[model samples]
Target: MALSKFGFIVTGAGFEPAGKRVVLSSEAFEMIAVGVPAPADALVVARQLASEGVQLLELCGGFGPVWTAKVIEAVGPGVPVGSVGYGPESIDVMHALFKA
Candidate 1:
């Protein structure tokens, strides 16, 4: 399925899921515009998550230019990665990169 803006909402951004109002973390704002370029650390994190039985992986489709390529490479050709964004430009870029 294509990504929706609602799917981009990350829960751990702050409030510890206390079943009440959600509070934003100070660092959440810091990470707002940061480009996540398929960090080497992400591979480690992904592997761990996979081992723990995670069935899906959501990657930021945010502007980092080569992030999608790196993710496609890192996930090693079979695993699926979801890129979050609902904009037409976002979809176009995803197609241009992943389809290539």
Candidate 2:
């Protein structure tokens, strides 16, 4: 059996859940989180995770450019960083639901 080299650090700008564990993809991962409430803190922790062999990093859709940049910088160019975003259709749907 061959398992892919995969790891990630999930951080946030508010509401820390330090040492919390959450299963991501069941067969994929379930990390013991070291949550921090600041992007700067996320950067520091993310760098540590990256050093420990995280080949990829990700952030939630709600994250804006600044947060994304911080994560990317921490993980460095060697690792591919990604962030989820609402596409145009998703945005339209949200607007529809909210009557915006």
Candidate 3:
């Protein structure tokens, strides 16, 4: 089936999912972007988006594999889930950027 609706979840400091969400739409497609303060918060947002008929969901690299799996499970098998990944070359840069 054609992908008409898509959802993307991003993680960062001080982001509130409800207040940070943006939806862009046109006659052919719709895209929803949401920001969460942490990876765990993405689970609820992901499920909510799936329930709202989002055909696919993508998570930011901050979520990693574990949170990606959790989101996939939360949304069940109907909606496809994916996450961004950085290559080895970006490991040090990413670490420096997200270091606590």
Highest-TM-score candidate: 3
lDDT of 2 at 61: 54
Could you give me the TM-score of model 2 versus the true structure?
0.60
lDDT per residue as tens, model 1, 1-100 = 4321111112222323221122223532311111223344355444443444334556554424365456556656445555655677567766786663
lDDT of 3 by residue, 1-100 (tens): 7999999999878898553899999999999999999888888899899999999999999888998999999999999999999999999998898778
Q: TM-scores across all candidates? A: 0.39, 0.60, 0.92
Runs in model 1 deviating more than 4 A are 1-40, 63-65, 86-100
TM-score computed on alpha carbons, candidate 1: 0.39
Q: Give the TM-score of candidate 3.
A: 0.92
lDDT by candidate, in order shown: 0.41, 0.60, 0.91
If both were scored by TM-score, which would come out higher, candidate 2 or candidate 3? 3
- Across residues 1-100, which tens digit of lDDT does each residue of candidate 2 receive? 2323344445554646342234354555434345565555567666766786666666655446888887887778987777767878698776775463
**Regions of model 3 farther than 4 Å from truth:** 17-19
lDDT of 3 at 59: 94
Which candidate's lDDT is highest? 3
